[model samples]
Target: MVARQFIVRHDDDDHHIEHDTDDGFEVLQSQIFSLTLVPPDQQKILANVNDAAINADSDLAAVSDRLVLVSVQDQREISISDEELARLLQAEEEAVYLQQFQASGNRREFENRVRTYVPQVFLYEDPMRQEAARKTVPVDEIEEKSLIFLAKETSGHQTMKKAMPSYWSYSLGSKNLSGGTSGMGMGVPLPSEIQYGGSRVELYWCNKCSKETRFPRYNDPIKLLETRRGRCGEWANCFTLYCRTFGYSSRLILDFTDHVWTECYSHLLGRWMHLDPCEGEYDKPLLYEKGWNKKLNYVIAISKEGVYDVTKRYTRNWHKVIRRRNITTEADISAVLSDITSECRRSFSREITSTLKIRDERETEELETNVHIPVGDSLSLPGRQSGSKEWRMARAELGSSDQNNSEQRHKDEYVDSHVTRIHAAFSHLTSRISKEGVKAIKKLLEDLRASPFRERTAVLESQGIPHLGDLLEAISLKGSVRPDGRVSVGLAGDPVLTSLALPVALDVVEKIINKGGNSD
Candidate 1:
């Protein structure tokens, strides 16, 4: 028997133990007992697939996989700090993510899946066939219960005037129920399951239609041309095919956060331009992040040409989005994508493929560059413009209409509170940090705060995101924020405070104090 690794979580931390014992999973419990002093009955061991037993090596898969042994005792819950619990949750998420990552990277299941589920499958054939379909939409005869119609109707706020279905239990509000569980692949769609296995069933209400209304859930995008009704998925699918049929090299993009859009390669600009058919939006990759306020993770673009991970193109907050990308190492994902792209282009001539490879490299560079460089000026991007106002708000994709107003109010309050903190820190630092004339630096900041907005704007620009205490060290020396909240030094980290040597952390403060750098 091959030895397996187990994370024996006892008190403060986790202990990894190896076991060659066979027979049943009780052997794992026994091994855990030897270390944690927890009895066999009290130990709860969980795996990625089965929490109950591991009869073979096949059950143990993926790099992040490990057995989590939880002790069932009185103090178990109480002893865990919020940080430790969060860490354990992240570990569990990584394990589940790795399982899917390996499965997605498998050449066999992947190619078949790509053929079936990837947006590239929705192709353009005869223009006449597309025209005919566009001209006609047959009444779709669906099975009585096959369709799940979900909705949120409101007079103003989200409230249920009429009682919903008694058996309809939803993870969120009044969505007409289709059952899902808490187990892997069985449960309600979770944050961690984005890239691996997914299915789309747009939940929208039909006005003046009965539950028995027979509408066909057409898989083919050509059929969507005539019907012309769908959520983001259908809209993007239909539009992508239309673009291709019209002689544009188009791709369909699937956002793992339950949205879909189109991308068309522009010969004029020699780049793929973002097109959200639903939003009537064009060329704005950061629209979802800046406008709809969508916290996106995985956004894969697929066409007849190739598959691409285009998530970075759609975000400026790559730092936060990175934590959700635990499906696999980026290198493994690139490997899988490269293989898939090769297979996709196998039919093309060597010259054509070479041209494609160059284009791919250029696009890759463009997307990576976009990760750091931000767009948009003083006026923020518009909110989600496609869905119903209520629906958009429910999705929290309503962007910065009323949100900007509320945020401004909150920001004013935050700035007022933060100014007091900055003043204290500045005072403390002025006493300790004597480099570059601390008095002058202090007076400079004080002038900036009391100065008019135009004068402050003349001096500093918006810099990095701000936080006060612990994070202050991270921002300090590297950047500065005007106490009035108008400007931030180091707009994209050029270091506007380079001339002044200021105390950032406790250690720096201690060193300065001990050196007697203060001019008292």
Candidate 2:
């Protein structure tokens, strides 16, 4: 049998034509043919096809036979013109550009833009044109054979079995209930009302501890299942396998942040629904079940349509849990869990109050020791007396001292008494301010400042004051009382003394003004 092969090239297409004959096939009209030559001393054998002869023959089959009988020994060569070559190159470039644009979602528009350029961009070489002139077998026969081979190779694998009706049962072993133990415990059953015609298989692997495991096919069940060992990613993979094994389309979806879950297409719903077995069953309230909650940390679900629906329910619940844990200063799991309860807000508020009380007490003691007050002969009353038992004893003996020292003792007693009264007043003011508003306390301070010095001193002495320095320090530290009852540096643009000194200064100023600005 003789066979003839022609290589044809167009601007953007290249194909081969083959003809079979009894004798060596002949090209009826020659354009270009392959030849072999020996060394310079030897003859060269050339093969050529006569295109005119083939065209002249009315019967193509008879012409093919005759051409195969004739042999011409000559090397045929055909070169493409520079312009044609440029055109071919241009066509190739355009094809690549159009393909890229199409891939980027501009297929129709790109094709329209290139349509006018296509004709000018493609040019056929002489050899290619001559090849195109020949006739050969139909193209469909070649395509048919190729498809047959592909089918043979692909269809050789064993088809997986259909899912069993019993497999749809929620039972693990004999248990009727769902979601308790692995294997023996009833697995979470697909809702019976929801018709699913796919295979089902369970998978298991630890995301954190075990090597990542991927099931070879959807139909294969996971070899092991352990509740505490695996994370959400592993659980998702298992569920996906179950659906795939049953011949239902399933996929393990992971978010950008490595959050893993399973998406199963429900034939009934005609949509993909996500399931998070590892996160546990959805709670009763949609917000509590799917919303941002502290116990679950971060949770977000994305639909196939590319919508991001992050549940703030989980987040809100988590925030409350953290706040409760922090306020109670309880680092235990129980405390953390308790905070997630409905009364979490009230519980945390109580904790905050307790902490504030402790802070206030410490602040009061510090203020009392830090204040300084001048005594007789430039001596500072309560000078380092905070740690002195001797000073306390001397002060305590003031009433029992001899008559000679009585005047001096009286002076000391008076200073002590005055300081005590100031301390008491400041303490009372703070208490009232805390209970009432700062505005009420500020008005009281204004009235005290307008009172006579003798009257204020008499009240202080009657109160049996002690530690004037402590009183001054407390008043100075507390600063001014704002209208809101907060102790601030300034109030209504006026600077007020510490809780201790506000009354004393107001009384002294009032007395001096009343006495026509006379010095004490």
TM of each candidate vs. truth: 0.43, 0.16
lDDT of 2: 0.32
lDDT (Cα, tens digit) per residue for candidate 2, span 1-520: 5465544332233334465543232332212131211111122112225443333224444443322212332222224467755664565455444444333343343223323222211211123322332122222333333333333333211111111111122222223222333322222324331122112333334333443222211211222222112334444544444444444544444332234555544333222344444443212112222222113322323221122213222222322322222212222222322322223224346776574345334333322221111112222122111112453354342222223343564685456454566656655434322222333334445644454321221112112123333433544432443455443322221122232356554554344344444222
- Candidate 1: which stretches are off by over 4 Å? 1-115, 119-122, 126-128, 131-211, 376-379, 402-520
- What does candidate 1's lDDT look like per residue over 399-494, in tens digits? 766457446646754453333454466556445434434333433444443433222322333333223222333324323446776444321222
Predicted candidate 2: what Cα RMSD to the true structure? 44.5
lDDT of each: 0.53, 0.32
For this target, which candidate reaches the highest lDDT against the unseen true structure? 1
